[model samples]
Target chain A: MVSIRDVAKAAGVSTATVARVLNGGTPVSPDRTERVLRAVQELDYVSNGVAASLSRGRTGLLGLLVSDIANPFTAQVARGLEDEAVRHGYQVLIASSDFDSEREAQVLASFARRTVDAVALLSSSGVGEGVARLIRNGIPTVFVDRRPPDLGEIPLVRTDSLSAAREAVRYLIDLGHTDLGMISGPAGMPTAAQRLAGFREACATAGLVVRPKCVREGFLGTQGGYTAMCEVLDLPVRPTAVFSFNNVLAIGALEAVRERDVRIPADLSLVTFDDTDLFPFVDPPITAIEQPAYDIGAEAGKLLFARIDGAETAGTDVVLPTRFHVRGSCDRPGR
Target chain B: MVSIRDVAKAAGVSTATVARVLNGGTPVSPDRTERVLRAVQELDYVSNGVAASLSRGRTGLLGLLVSDIANPFTAQVARGLEDEAVRHGYQVLIASSDFDSEREAQVLASFARRTVDAVALLSSSGVGEGVARLIRNGIPTVFVDRRPPDLGEIPLVRTDSLSAAREAVRYLIDLGHTDLGMISGPAGMPTAAQRLAGFREACATAGLVVRPKCVREGFLGTQGGYTAMCEVLDLPVRPTAVFSFNNVLAIGALEAVRERDVRIPADLSLVTFDDTDLFPFVDPPITAIEQPAYDIGAEAGKLLFARIDGAETAGTDVVLPTRFHVRGSCDRPGR
Candidate 1:
């Protein structure tokens, strides 16, 4: 029920000053800006300002395709993309592929038919063919999260999965976990390949012998993690520590450990590749590498917009850094 | 990389049959449909069909405005909506309102400017004015999750927050928790109002004291929940239990409880209004009312499409059921 007038009155500012703060293109004084913002938040006043006139023939629509929306990581990336796209006067039409490569291709084709101004793909697995088609058609596309192996000149916005993975592995090794195990995605996917590379490099560098049984193939899915974890648990020599390469895997691995009566950081240590709010709330708060999904999304949107604006330089790969959030899950590995 | 020909060959169907199965124009027999689907899944084939030549003059875009995308519940709803929309040969342009009514209005206006065919307004706190404007503008709008009070005959697709909330509160009281508190969203918001109504009605029916101190105002935000939980913990007679009516609030409430060393289900029983996959992994996995968000989304998409297809009828309010998922968090009240 609160209006701009009410906000203006509350802040002792004019309606124009309030408008200037709410919408860009006009500027207000520092004190006025602060007062207007505070008044807006206090009054919960939403401006009915229409977006600046969109460029003609530009539908002002961008296409975003992800493997899954239910995944917290993917959803966060999507939030970042949607927020940034809206800021640039573009609305995003998001499609989920459910990790199905074919569905991914179909979604892209649908986007093409809709004639979106540009596209942002989040770390595709089986959809490289669809992406190739997009590139062949000359549509502005930005790869996010994971890039295709042969995407020679495509701009990519991804987190440093390799270094983060390596550091996490190294951290576990430092904690005296010589016999460590990893639950990883299918070996063929680019993100999976990079993560696996990190795991191998870290183990090899630390003079730790990573037997073939210690590395289990997973689909980056909960069930995949459960099955893989069970395999590791049934091995003759139980791993002193486990590093799940993604969120769902971590969840499944934890469930397996719980089922087996294995205590985290006591009987075994744990490290997960991705982090979520849930991690902090869980028992033995999980140690994880926080993938900055939002930043990747924001950066992808910026790159896509730049291409739409006719940025003609070769593709720029924006590799955002990852951070390690250590909690009670990882500790010294007892004999 | 799998082509229609390959799928047809693998499934022992003609190319036309494969096309008919993937695209909805012509219905294929059950046997052929099964074969085609299996072939598609096995081969990882994605049909690049351009959505069955959508009706000319139809923009083939539906606008979905939600309060938050980062929220798991919202994200799941979005996934369901996107999947259903895709099946119907439409794509969704999603915008997050961040529970701000003003931003909701602006996003609707932008959707209008872009000529999206119809819209699905997800549960939100502050955008009735914008929604009303859309209704007046005669753009097909289906209110999702939260419907505006006094809005004449606006179709709504929502989970039953009222009955479910009442039952949850009553369930706790049945276990002998005479004292109770609730973390509720801001007043005057439709969803918040409904939930609060349920809480009050339940307490009154049970002859429990409905003191103002038992109710804490929150924004359905993490900070809101944190502040409200702090207040509730400081209450002279802290309630035997607390029900956080939303996800973030529940998280904040749990954190506060943990900080205070309040043993869940022993010192204080806890119940949250929504469920996420993360709940189970946490210690004393949260007991929650699981809102079937995917069904709501899928149904909303169907309704919007029906409206778009010119189904003239009175507004339909489809209220889905909510199921209680009790974990280790809720039990008999103890000293």
Candidate 2:
């Protein structure tokens, strides 16, 4: 291991000079700085984070909590967060709660114990209680993807799910489809509730009857969508078009329609919320409400740093817009 | 926040007894344990990891290095690793390198500074040069997915890429396809090289000639696969069947064929390496070589713990098998 003393001795300078160069404390002469850097490279010196943290009383780490890592949407959000965090000279410690409230609480406590400079969450469950408790105890927190119930002024980064849902529903309505159904996400999730509300609002504005039989709440994955679609398909008067609240549900609906030999845009029209890089490859290319997931993550990261830098004011909410991607899956009935 | 003294007073036990109950150090009367547990629940006591580390002289945190977090394959591997790690009373610190060697080295140095108990890597770019320094300094490490060039004896958990590729190619061959092309992964990646070797060996065994125009190398992602497929499509003598080295490439090939109006199976047969949860949902349903990614991660985790426990032996390599899933994409040349 190359110590500051070794670098100082190699460069014929004092150890304080080497320390100053490494820590960027005070400027050193260009010649001495070059010598110190050369010695560092040659010796392959790696700083000890534990020792540094002990001296500085900070870990230079940020903690992130997500509902699940297996979900591609959440994974993409994490990717954006990590990119921005690393750029800002911070590392991330990630924890997944699997949408379990107890697990979310445990992860929150763990993050606090690690003394991370700040925390971010993509919480669907009401783990905001734990987060609020942490805030009361003076830990900086920023919520992403899901807005907590009592988020009054707390910094939140999210997509405009309600408006996105309305846009998707309106697109289907424009396609000359009156009989519509929806497969929604889990009931308690704020985003899911907002999307459902948007769907109803769109139906009322268009003078289309919103039937109770058309909606089902469950997991936001393929199986959930499949089961929900089955229910809708079994109705005495089945919907001619379906708006899936998320991509997983849309995928499930596609599979369901295919299994039943229902021709897309001929017998049924479909549109999904959220788009991924892989979505374009699907046959009949899905019409989607594309959320700016990457931008949301970057914005949340910047906000978190702001809070960490003593922006003691109550955090603000940032809702990014979603774009409607018109593709082959959405078209006029009997196309 | 509840203290041990509070729990002790409520349970009518000494503080030492309360501590032992919380740490699960010794057996206590069931009645007393229940009382203490109730008190803990009522008071909402959360254990602090840093404070515990200070008392125990270890943080109980492990570091994980992944090539990319956005890659679904890597994400699945990480999920498996973390699942096993958490079960054994450890949390993971994740860092991604984006396939850059310098970033990988930086993450390695960062993990070491944190004094992580062990480190696991999903796809390491460079050989054990930088990590060898960590090993010399007494840090335990286990490589997953990819291994260093010189660290032959180091602990490694990887899928049998040779067999996986052979099976994927043989599946296409068995489907009555003769002219086949392959989209390979980036150069210098051990898994990619091994997969290519397997493909070549399978062709040689069947007395099939591999055309020079049939192979191209780049990162394993949607764009990489797409670019390679564009190159393959531009060739004067295009293959009747194609085998993509990984799922990302398979996705790219799917898109390319769609763009070119090339009908799958009827016009081109396709098979891919590494099946993910999302693979089956793609249109035409891709056939794939399914590597036991989760098992590999679990095995690597166990290996790391074994080393940490002072197994007193040289590191070992464990290679798991791959299964080929036949789907709708491959067929007889005439379809």
Candidate 3:
């Protein structure tokens, strides 16, 4: 509650002198500046952000929107974004839409109303049009983990989902598994579609047919994966190997197999996408496609800051690569 | 970019008419309100937050400070806070201090300067005085996860760490283990202290001696846990049972034990604090204390909003319970 007048009174100086010292206006005598600083600290004077922001026409706040905050993958990316944003002297305002397009739009509109300096969106459910409107209104936006089809000139950071899926499938294939099934995320998601495309491409290149009955699409949570795995297990010719599009799906599949008393590798080989630090501890350590989630988040943050700093050029897209980690889960089929 | 004037002109109404329609002040003719709404949609007009805030003397922005964001426990809590804040018509700005008191102070100052309506802090490093100052300045402040000493009448939401730790240790003792080791978090953290106290109490009640060499203190991360486990393994009388303060430590111990080729439960029973969804998938599913992190976050957020809504006697501490989940990691000795 210390005002400039209080600091001035404590420092034996005029209010104008204190203001000058604080704002660096017309270089004050060094001794006087020191006295004012001491008084300010002693009084615990805090600047009024409303007055400062009104004078400057901008606040040091950036908005971040994600599809779901509970997902480990999104949470990791958010951590990276927050770390980078803090380092750059910006604060992040976060909102989650639960993968609903209308909710995503509402969140974006809210951010726009707040007039955040920039926005970082992880819009897996395709709310590009809402983002386009923000860009048109001169709000800098950077998409993370999900890229829009027509966002050719907008800034985006995403993992190479197609390549990651291909590598994951290839790892299982290399382990001498022929009968393969896939548990994909919701069909409308770009990342899921890309992964499925990669899986089919890998199968075709290996002279194998991707059976229609071997794929199921649903939510990306553990239950979704569980239900998908159950469907796959019901097939007369159940696959000896399976590639799950995300970590939650892989976990669900693992649970299903364990409940059914199926021994890993001997009965089934599994590979998952989007590996995290926790995966190594799984029963039989899962072989997984590890994307650069942290890197993608950091890069997206950097890009958004650049745009906020008046980079007028159309933003570019960045696709980080994935690493295939081979572990206890993906062994030779029937080993 | 569209202003009220532009909307009024486009809608063929006076500016005051447009303003009335937007603010719902007075009964605007329904036809005129419709026209104004149509013009706003067509022009894609976004409200100017700066102008509105300046006029109202408040911004609908809340600040959230966390010691660490990458930790699954912290991340889940953050998700709950975000969900509740959004529902209550507030936006959350987040900062991570990595348990550094200085960094936390800086973030608090920054949030104060941004004129945030309130702040919710997950202060694991114990610096409540700074936040108390903000509250004195009329900024509503709420603490989560870690309670600071003498936060006289300030609000806080935390889990029952003492009881949780007691349950974990008692579970190990019931399995017929006497020689116990513990991996504690940094010395000053209240949660760590409470858990340690609970562990000692359990030992005393069970007539077991506490060995000084069996306790290690550091950040609750994988590396810290791994190094602590190494030290415990080197002890002349290695513990038959171990309790980790968090999941990161549990994971680190898992890797260390794997490297040492020591079998879990059979050689050393282990229980960790803060159960995560990932635990169930682990090779030997980790036994853990499940803190109600999401509830704590949601409650803190709700308390903050209640304070903001002019609650006369708002600052109250809320403590939730933790549940013990026994899994494969803790079993009868020599299983």
In order of appearance, the predictions have TM-scores of: 0.83, 0.88, 0.94
Least accurate 10 contiguous residues by lDDT in model 3 chain A:
A308-317
* Fraction of native A-B contacts kept, per candidate: 0.51, 0.56, 0.78
Candidate order by DockQ, decreasing, is: 3, 2, 1
Mind giving the per-residue lDDT tens digits that candidate 1 earns over B217-261?
Answer: 887678888889889988888888888889878888877887888
Rank by lDDT (best first): 3, 1, 2
Say which docking band candidate 2 falls in.
acceptable
Each prediction's whole-model lDDT (CA): 0.80, 0.78, 0.81
lDDT, candidate 2, A52-134, per-residue tens: 66456567778888877767777777778878888888888887776678878877877766447678888768775678667
Which candidate should be chosen as best, given DockQ against the real structure?
3
Query: Residue A192 CA error for candidate 2 (Å)?
Result: 0.4
* Model 2: pairs clashing at backbone N, Cα or C within 3 Å: none
**Which pairs in model 1 have colliding backbones?**
A46-B102, A123-A146, B101-B126
Q: Write the per-residue lDDT of candidate 3 for residues A102-203, one digit (tens) a residue.
A: 878877877776457788888667676678778778888887887677776777788888877887787777777777899998987888999999998888
The TM-score between candidate 3 and the true structure equals 0.94
**How many residue-pair clashes does candidate 1 contain?**
3
- The candidates' DockQ values read 0.25, 0.44, 0.67
* Error in Å for residue A80 of model 2: 1.1
The top-ranked prediction according to TM-score is: 3
Best by lDDT: 3
Off by over 4 Å in 3: A1-20, A23-26, A30-43, A312-315, B5-17, B313-315
